[model samples]
Target chain A: MQKQENLSKNQKIILDLIEKSSGPLKAYSILFNVKKQGIKAPLQVYRALDKLIEIGKIHKIESRNAFVACKNSNCQVSKATAFSICENCEDVTEVSNLKLSKYLSNFADKSGMKYNKYNLEFFGLCKNCKK
Target chain B: MQKQENLSKNQKIILDLIEKSSGPLKAYSILFNVKKQGIKAPLQVYRALDKLIEIGKIHKIESRNAFVACKNSNCQVSKATAFSICENCEDVTEVSNLKLSKYLSNFADKSGMKYNKYNLEFFGLCKNCKK
Candidate 1:
């Protein structure tokens, strides 16, 4: 079983920043936070983000080239770590539900295809923004 | 409710190309297919993809800067159209379920956050690819 662990000081702030983010965060944003805490160099921030992700505590959002913490704390409940991002506010609100995920998985399994699986990212405004 | 309509003769080929694809497709790949049908200029295919997406007939996978058709025929059952895409083969499996989606939505709603929701796209090899 994968266990959740606290990130290092540098990693914590970066994680904390993303956890509080309204939208997906670019690598620069993470780097910015690191500089504020007396950490220097782009490498430091990237390394921290890389390590945190490897620990399974965070995920990289490929669409926006950003990152976010895994909202789910553990694997017991089997919650997905992916989400839907709003292009306007950059606020990520999980997703529109899991029905889409299961359907895709089943579809691929039936297709007899072998590939790397990625979460789908949709960019758009929320209901409020539409108004 | 939005209605599904067949694309124009030109758009049909583009849509067909994506629909029959086993994985997500990049814009260049779309352009590749477009050229095969005597169509030139990248704008033509992009316009077609844009229009298809607008009518809610097809979806753009932002993570890969690629595209795929909506597997769902209608919105009555209320399916989240995002997916889990494979990095290696570019094959997309729906997800590894709705629980993740519902949870994210509930978390956001509870957080008093108004955001443009996006499906979180993750990248990794499938079970077979791992072997």
Candidate 2:
């Protein structure tokens, strides 16, 4: 693969965490795991995570207070807002399917409401996490 | 409506709050509103809410720390787990479509994993919240 944007040591570690996770992961787990690699302090990881989220390099699983890599980096996923999560596998996947997004978009247009943010979630076992 | 289980005055007030809301509500907002109605202790409301959630009387919007009454009280919805939520109007909806439910179930069967609890969320403007 073409070399993705080079990241600092901290970012690289976080990226690896998302890449290797069985499913989506919460921030606390990231904080705990990063320390295993010798990164110190609570804020350093979150700061790096925040930056990762901002650049669309990663996505936050809003319901679980966790982060996951955007399955499709080129897709238009927004980190500042909300998205769906799979409960079983702990994998946070993007919910940008055209049908669902448009269904919700139509709802917003009719409501005439402006919110700084919003959330949508579906809780269930994932394709992998299910029993 | 067949009189559901009779509720204490505090519980009754909470039901009314859910009934009148334009969308789902977080626990803190319920506490504030209950207090406005003269329920003295904060614990009383949460205690009631906890039970409401336990007995499948109300659904928790995990992403937003909020609650909504089950639109279909008679449906087999579980209060112990997660479900989809609408971010726009704060409405919580169930994602029990047979196709999706089976999709997740098969994945879990293969993974051999179990979680005491899980989260599933979706974020977007509602049919009404989209301007």
Candidate 3:
């Protein structure tokens, strides 16, 4: 994992906000939440987010255009990451199963193509949402 | 699979453009490509896209904010879908492996949450791009 000390001031601020959220946070929402901290522009937020993502401190939920802090300690080195998303509640849970990650890393297509990185998002009703 | 005859005019026009593409097509790109076919507004294209996605005629590449035609005959009924994306070339290929789909459909997390729908996007250099 990349050392936390390497994060810039803005990156740390944004990452902290994401880590505190119960669910994923969108860029605009994050910007709004951090405005008091002197993050006045969207580009500042985006640049910090891009850096955070590069260091594996945060991940973007592509489907929702939201960001979430990486939950797994081993996630920085893992080539595959998966998330279970509740469509109704908008809750996102990162899957950290070693076996699952191994299976996906070794998976090959008909053309025998192998992938170096993968993001899987599963959509369904959460336990509470199903009730 | 949803019958092709069930598609509305605008849906058909947008679907054809997506299907004919070598890679995924974004909503605005689809609208631009079909403007001569009478698709005048972004909402019209989005509405048709939502319907097409609902019926499984096309699948969205969440990371790229683009849509691609489902290449597998069995894809309409499958609960899980996976794509291998070439990061360098921006090429996307849908993975239609029965075994992979089955494995994911049955996958459970630590809380024993099983997903009804999943979309996996793998990123890597394609065979041609690697050379």
Candidate 4:
């Protein structure tokens, strides 16, 4: 992963916007939000997003087609990711449980497939949504 | 989940195509394949894909944005899904491990969040790819 200081101008601008967002932001919405900052064009947003995701500065919630900042300071690569999504409210929370990560990371099957990465998503109602 | 007999014409077409496929099929690719069969619009493809996924006849590989037929005969709902994806060869296999599925289904975190659905994907090189 490249250092944050090495980020290009557009990358920094896009990353900053995502980091400030309270929840995941879609590519179009990110492009819309940064339009005032001279970041025009959907391709530009996608390019920056690709780089941001590559650098582990942001992660895409594949189910939602949205991007969120990596809250784990220890995450240098976006290889292993798990998220809990509230079906009712569409709330997404990054799961950082050590045991769960370890279990998945060490998971092996009879297929003899050695895994290098994994992504898990859990869906249900959140605490607030349960009320 | 609906019975196989309840599937609409478009859904049956899409499901049959996916089931016959050995690999995952992307939305546009599915659209292109079914075009000759009288399904013209992209929305038609998407709608059928959505219903097929809902009924567990298909599962979308979120990482690849591709759809694969559910190989597990016992899986009547598209709730818990796990797959082994070969990074090098792009070979995707639906994982049907009873232990893994049970573990994930019973998984609970300290956040008091109860999950009703989950999707897990593992990425690695397949035996053929590794060779």
Q: What share of the true interface contacts does each candidate keep?
A: 0.48, 0.21, 0.66, 0.78
If both were scored by lDDT, which would come out higher, candidate 1 or candidate 3? 3
Every model's DockQ? 0.26, 0.19, 0.69, 0.80
Candidate 4 recovers what fraction of true contacts? Answer: 0.78
* Candidate 4, pairs of clashing residues: none
Q: Candidate 3's residue-wise lDDT over A21-81, tens digit each?
A: 9999999999999999999999999999988887788888888999999998756643577
Candidate number with the higher TM-score (2 or 4): 4
lDDT of 1 by residue, A23-124 (tens): 667888778766868877888889888887776667777656788767665522222444555556666655434555554343343334443444555455
Specify the CAPRI tier of model 3.
Answer: medium
In candidate 2 chain B, where is summed lDDT lowest over 10 consecutive residues? B107-116
Model 3, B1-131: lDDT tens digits are 33679788998888888888999999999989999998899999999988888877898888889999988865564357788999888998888788888888888876545478988888888888887
> Which regions in candidate 1 have their CA more than 4 angstroms from the true location?
A1-23, A28-48, A69-79, A82-88, A93-131, B1-6, B38-41, B74-79, B82-88, B93-109, B112-131
Best-first order by TM-score: 3, 4, 2, 1
- What's the lDDT for residue B99 in model 1? 59
- Which candidate achieves the best DockQ against the true structure? 4
Of 1 and 2, the candidate ahead on lDDT is 1
Comparison by TM-score, 2 against 3, better one: 3
> Which residue window of length 10 is worst by lDDT in model 2 chain A?
A107-116
lDDT for each residue of candidate 4 in B46-81, tens digit (9 for 90 to 100): 999998888788999999999999999977789999
iRMS, model 3 (angstroms): 1.5
Clashes of 3: 0
Query: In candidate 3, which residue ranges exceed 4 Å CA deviation?
Result: A1-4, B1-3
TM-score of chain A of 1: 0.73
Cα TM-score per model? 0.56, 0.57, 0.94, 0.93
